[model samples]
Target: MEFIALDILPFSVVDDVCFRRLVEHRYTLPSRSYFSDVSLPELHSIVETYIHELLAMGVTAISFTTDIWTSDVSPISMRSLTAQWVNEDFVLRKAVLHAQECAGSHTAAAISMAFEKMFETRKNPKNKVHAVLRDNAHNTTKALEECGVASLPCMAHTSGNR
Candidate 1:
C-alpha cells in the first residue's frame, strides 16, 4: 500500500488528511527515503521484466515510431520512440518505449546512435523492428538508411503534403 501510494501520488499526498483517515492509522507509512531507494528501483525492475516478456511473445514483427522535439521548459532536445506489435493473443499492443535526451545535434549519425540505444532495451532491436515511422525529415531518412531499417513517413504528414 505504501509502495503504491508513493509510486503513483506526489510525496505531499502522504500527509493528506483524507488518505490518513482512510488508512485508519493501522499501517505505519513508509518515509520518502524508502520510496526513493526501494519502490522506485522495484518499479524500474518490474517494467524491464514486462518489456522482456513482450519481446518473448509470439509476433511476426514489430514496428516503431519516433520523433524529436525540444520542450520549452528544457534546453535539451529529446527523442520519443513508440513500439507497435500484435501480441500472441492476436491483440494489437502499442507502447511508448522511450523519451531520451539526444546525444548531440540531430544529425543522421547521432539519431542512429540514439535509435540503437533505445532498441537495445529489447536486445537485437534491429531484427525485431521491421521499420520506423517518422516525419519526412532528411536526417530521419538518412538515419534509417545508415541503420539498415526501412523508413516509413507518417501518413498524416504525407497526406497533408498532398
Candidate 2:
C-alpha cells in the first residue's frame, strides 16, 4: 500500500512523507522503504511493463491524439502521437494511452516508418493496429494509407460549418 501510495496516489513528496508517517503510527508498521531502493528509471520500466500488458489486452488502440507546443514562453514546437484504448471491467471504465516523441519536420514516409518501428517493438503486433482509426493530418493520413490501412478523419475535430 505504501509503495502504491508513493507511486500513484495524488500527493507530493511532503504529502507522501506525512501519509507514510500517519500510516506507520496508525498501523504500527514501518513506512515503505522501497522508494529508497528503486530508481526512477527502474520505476519507469516497471510502469512500462504494465502499459504493455494493457495494450496487448485491447485496452488501447492505434488511434492517437497529437498536438504541438513549447515548454518555454517562446514557442519552439514539438509534436507527438498517442495510442488510446478502453478497459471496461465490472465497475470501472478506464482508458489507457501513451505518447511517443516525434518530429514535426518528418515526412509521411518517415512518420509511417517510425510508427511501424514502434509497433514492431510492442509485444503484440496484432493489438497495435486499429484498422478504423484515422490520422488527422494529410501527411499522416497518407502514411497510414501506405500501410494499406483505412484511415478516417476524427469527426470531432472537423471544422464546424456554421
Candidate 3:
C-alpha cells in the first residue's frame, strides 16, 4: 500500500501479473479492493500522525509553499500545500500537508479558503507560519494577504530566474 501511494500507482497494480508474481513468491498479496478500501486510509492516518509528531517536537516555525495547477489529462485542478521546518535534530524537513482537488474557480477567496482548510485539517496554528512561498499570481498574493500571512514569490517561477 505504501508503495502504491508513494509511486502514485493505481490500486489495480497489485493485480498485475508481473507484480503478483514478483511478490507472491514470498508474500501474499491482498485484493486491490482491500488496499483501496482499507490499507490506503490506514497508511494516510499513519503518515499524518508521524508528521504531527515531528512538528510537535521542538519545531518553532514553519514555512509553507502552495500552488494550484490543472492536470494535462483531465480538467481537475489540484491545490497543494507543503510545510518546511527545521527539526529538533537541526535537520530541515518538509511534508506535503495537502494535495486536494479544487471544485470551482481559482479565485483569491477560493485559494485562501483551501489554504485555511489545509491548516485546520492538520491542526496547525496559523500563527506558526513564517511565510508562504507561492507563484506570482495576483490571486495567490491576494489570498496570502487575505489570510494575513507573509508571502514570497517563488523564484523558480519568476521570469529569467531559472
Candidate 4:
C-alpha cells in the first residue's frame, strides 16, 4: 500500500506479473480492489489522526497556502490547502490539509466555504491559521478575506515567475 501511494503508481500495478514476482519472495500483494477500497481509507484515517494530534499539541500558529486550478486535458478543477508550522521541538512540519475536486465555479464564496470545511473537518481552529499565502487572483484574495483570514500574495505569482 505504501509503495503504491508513495510512488503514485496505478492500482493495476499490483496485478502485474513481473512486479508480483519481484516482491512475492517477502511480501504478498493484495488485489487492486483491496487497495482502492480498504487500504486507502485506512491510510487516510491514520494520516488524518496524526494531523489532528499534531495540531492539537504545541502548535500555536499555522501558515497556509491554497490554490485552485483546472486541468487542460480534463474539466476537473482542484483546490488544495496546505499548512506549515514549527513543532514543539522547533522542527518545521508541513501537511496538505485538503486537495479535493471543485464541483462548480471557483467563486470567492465557494473557495472560502471549501477552506472552512477543511479546517472544520480537521478540527483545527480558525484562529490558529496565522496567514494564507496565495496567488493574487481576485477570487482567491476575496475568498480569504471573506473567511476573515489574513492573506499574503505569493511572490512568484506577483513576479510572473509561476
Q: Which prediction has the highest TM-score against the true structure?
A: 4
The stretch of ten residues in a row with the least summed lDDT in candidate 4 is: 20-29
**Candidate 1 lDDT by residue in tens digits, 8-37:** 777655577887788757798777667668
1 or 4: which has the higher lDDT?
A: 4
Off by over 4 Å in 1: 1-11
User: How should the candidates be ordered by TM-score, best one leading?
Assistant: 4, 3, 1, 2
How much is 92 displaced in model 1, in angstroms?
0.8
List model 2 lDDT by residue over 1-162, tens digit each. 345546675324534656657565556532335343454446667767877766656454445454434467754545454555555442222223335556556578876776566556645364445653543667777776665555667676565421
Cα lDDT of model 4 by residue, 40-109, tens digit? 9999999989988998788999999888888899999888899999999998999998998888978899
RMSD of each: 2.8, 5.8, 2.1, 1.9
Report model 2's TM-score to 2 decimal places: 0.55
lDDT of 4 at 10: 94
Predicted structure 4, TM vs. truth: 0.93
Q: What TM-score does model 1 achieve against the real structure?
A: 0.81
Misplaced by over 4 Å in model 4 are 25-28
lDDT digits (tens) for residues 71-120 of candidate 3:
89999988889999999889999999988888898899988887788888
- The CA lDDT at 34 in model 4 is 97
